[model samples]
Target: MGKLKKIETEIEGVYIIEPTIFGDERGFFFESYNKRDFQEIGILDEFVQDNHSKSRKGVLRGLHFQTEHSQGKLIRVIKGGVLDIAVDLRKDSATFGKSIKVELTEENRRMLYIPKNFAHGFLTITEEAECLYKCNDYYYPEYESGIIWNDSELNIDWELKKYNLKKEDLIFSEKDKRHQSFKEYKKAGGER
Candidate 1:
């Protein structure tokens, strides 16, 4: 689809996609994803799993990825908005241990494509937001791993206070809160 525009980030393989929108009195229309067009832009991986989640404001879902079955994700917001993030975990990569953040909102209609060997996460910025993503690999619970969202080593600039929320206001699952730090992830051999 000529409707798609791919924006490259500082990190290699990660991209922000802007789909051309046609608006009128009847509202708007845009192609979310077209395999051929996506392949044209280097997003040639085939998506095997589709996942959706809903969360309230101040809720943070991850900094998560699989070790043995690493996934490349194409993520977007279907309702409300979120601050989506991807952290490079490939030890051999020039940008390893670095992260990129982007805002995905229903209004902006932006999407993010995170390559495999990266940890992914997001924070809900609206009262409630629905996030949808396509994964190139299947989910394998046994291979799951994550880095603590607040790891000092990564020091992600979540800007939670800018959204009028304190760190105390953030809701996290027990698993997320207890995840290993980036240092620990590296110490463990950093397998992608």
Candidate 2:
């Protein structure tokens, strides 16, 4: 198992990392992240918070980020799989208003690094999915906020066309529904 590839995007501080996997009759193993290797690849974040979530299929978790104490995240799935998404919300970024989506699964051993000032979300693709992430800052409830996952302005192709998503299955908090869209959020100086 070795470092397979690093995909740097137009969005600053965003990356997709694919690690080499070695399998045998027993099982498979891979190095998820090595601090030295991360530094070499220019991912110099020192994560201080770790979060894990489990969700059933059709469960959608966000378009969430912090307005005050924003977090940069290194996200991946440990079991099953999900369609992970990151939307650029940084008002000053070149990629502002753009979004990137990727599939993450145990088999792929891939991870996404999302820098601060972006909204993060995922949709469970398997019967069940276990997602984990390392965050550069501790979560602050007061500062936590989100945009509607289906917001038209951002125009994220969640690729949910194949999945049978029910109204109940597309779960969200009341707050998420009311959160500002990119255009509105930007006009209100939502960027940090």
Candidate 3:
């Protein structure tokens, strides 16, 4: 349990998890997500699904969530790195419409826990990146929906140029490109 440190983000339920690493001439080792360590921080929900994804530089994959069965995700990068992002959507919360971003890399071995009711997404920062995550709920595409990534109202400040990538350099699915705006989400009554 002592091997993990959980740091709260400005957003109420988001957390940055750092694990103590033991390294030597050979390599390094650490418990990526120990149940005991997680329990110590009051994250008691059991993860029901594990997901993995690989993306090339300039690939951006979300701002998505399930409207009916929202998922809480614990995300980490293994092969390279990414700018992981989460946006709060709880209408009654102070941080609603706010966001938090973190750089998750192989070297840092850090992870982000994004609770339900937030949009989750990431941009691959290296030539390629491999991401793994545990989810508290299984995916249900029928209930899937998203807020558009570059909504003016959210003012996400993705800092795309800092990574030497421009908006045109990014790759997005037509579905993601057409996601609703934050304003639309609000008009629709937010989070079914």
Candidate 4:
């Protein structure tokens, strides 16, 4: 058995994964992903896609989801740090609308698993950051949707000042700047 521990968060279907590292003068070694170990922890989905992204400090990426091809993701940071956020959007789930945040850094070597049907996003907390993620599904631009990062109703703490940043300091893709509000999304009939 690999040295992996899966920690459940307050939100159902979300998990924090820790792997035992062996280090010496040679450096450190650990299995980043083991199918058997992951399956043992009840994460059964087969991830088909891997994505890597590098963002500069004060870059806020998402709160994005897909109405049709929703994706479940297992994510970790390979360089620098980020405050990753996941929001439950399963209408029937008891924890619907609740969100959880996890700090991922290269030093910690931690991963966050967010099941399908959740909105996911993150803010770069250092000068620069690189993130790697595995997704159970492929991307489809036509079905992509997102909630505004600062949606008042969702009430996520982006920690601008804590990172020595103001909202204006954050950089975003033009598309992300036009995402709908959480309240408006629901009112328009969710998962449409």
Candidate 5:
């Protein structure tokens, strides 16, 4: 098994993982994931799929989760960096409605774990960013759902200045731009 250090986030199920990297002037190497090592740190979920995406700075992609195949993601950046965000939505939990943000970059090699039932998203901070993540369940398009990234109630700081980005500079897909607000998502019982 690999050596991985787990750092707990403020939220109950989320975690920040620091993988042991071996490097020199020749470059570096590290095991991104090892099933046995992950379990030793309490990440028991079995990952069923791997996803990758590339985006430029100012691109904002989500606050989304699936109702049917809700995914718990282990996210990392392979090239460049981003501002990763996750919002707690499990109604019965004490930290419900809370959110956490972590700055992930290729140079840092840190990873964030977003348990199922939470909304997940990221804003690209570098000129270009490539993200890779593992999901615990298969995605079902019919179950795609999200909360608008700027919902006032969530109070996410976003930390746009890290990349000299302004509110007007962020880009979004048409669907992300039209997502439901926090109140609307809750009113529709999406939390349940």
Candidate 6:
């Protein structure tokens, strides 16, 4: 039997998956994604896009979501490790504005599943880290939107304090900085 660990939070559809790891003296092995198993477990989304990114410590990449085409993400660390995060941006959801954080490392071999309508981001815990993810929809550049990672309103305990982040090191795009706050977003029906 596979090991299933569910994190029940106020968030609507955030899941942390720790698949069964088979380890011997030689090494360890596990199924990152199995369609049959996923279906059995009710994760039936067909991932149509995949993305990979490499980042150095102190490089923050996001609180991003596509407005027009929401995407569910199945993410894992391939090379190093990171503190992955997802924020429930679905306005209609009871958990809207809530966020979940998880650590994905090479040794842990764990993956996170962020359903559609959630904003996703991560911080590198190691000097260098690689993140790979499967998406339910192709990335729509025009529809992409983001929120400021350090927005006081979200109050995400990014744990960046431990990393000694400087104002300049907290990188963000102009678009991200201009994103509406949680309250403003909800008033406009951010969820679809």
RMSD to the true structure for each prediction, in A, is 1.2, 2.0, 1.2, 1.0, 1.3, 2.5
At residue 7, candidate 1 shows an lDDT of 99
Q: Write the per-residue lDDT of candidate 3 for residues 69-101, one digit (tens) a residue.
A: 889999999999999999998878899999999
lDDT tens digits, residues 25-135, model 1? 999988887898898887898999999999999999899999998999999999999999999998889999999999999999999999999999999999999999999
Residue-pair clashes, model 6: 0
TM-score of 2: 0.91
Give the per-residue lDDT digits (tens) of candidate 2, residues 1-192. Answer: 366478987677789988778889999888777777778788888989889999888888888999998899999899999999999987787888899998999777799999888999988888888989999899999888787788788888877766666556666557766776777677768842
Residue 102 displacement in candidate 4 (angstroms): 0.5
What TM-score would every model get versus the actual structure?
0.97, 0.91, 0.97, 0.97, 0.97, 0.87
How many collisions per candidate? 0, 0, 0, 0, 0, 0
Task: Tell me the deviation in Å of residue 21 in model 3.
Answer: 0.7
lDDT of 4 by residue, 39-154 (tens): 98899989999999999999999989999889999999999999999999999999889999999999999999999999999999999999999999999999999999999989
Looking at model 1, residue 65 earns an lDDT score of 93
CA error at residue 132 for candidate 5, angstroms: 0.2
The candidates, ranked best first by lDDT, are 4, 5, 1, 3, 2, 6
Worst 10 residues of 2 by lDDT: 164-173
Judging by lDDT against the true structure, name the best candidate: 4
Candidate lDDT scores, in order, read 0.92, 0.83, 0.91, 0.93, 0.93, 0.80
lDDT of 1: 0.92
Residue ranges of candidate 4 with Cα displaced over 4 Å:
none
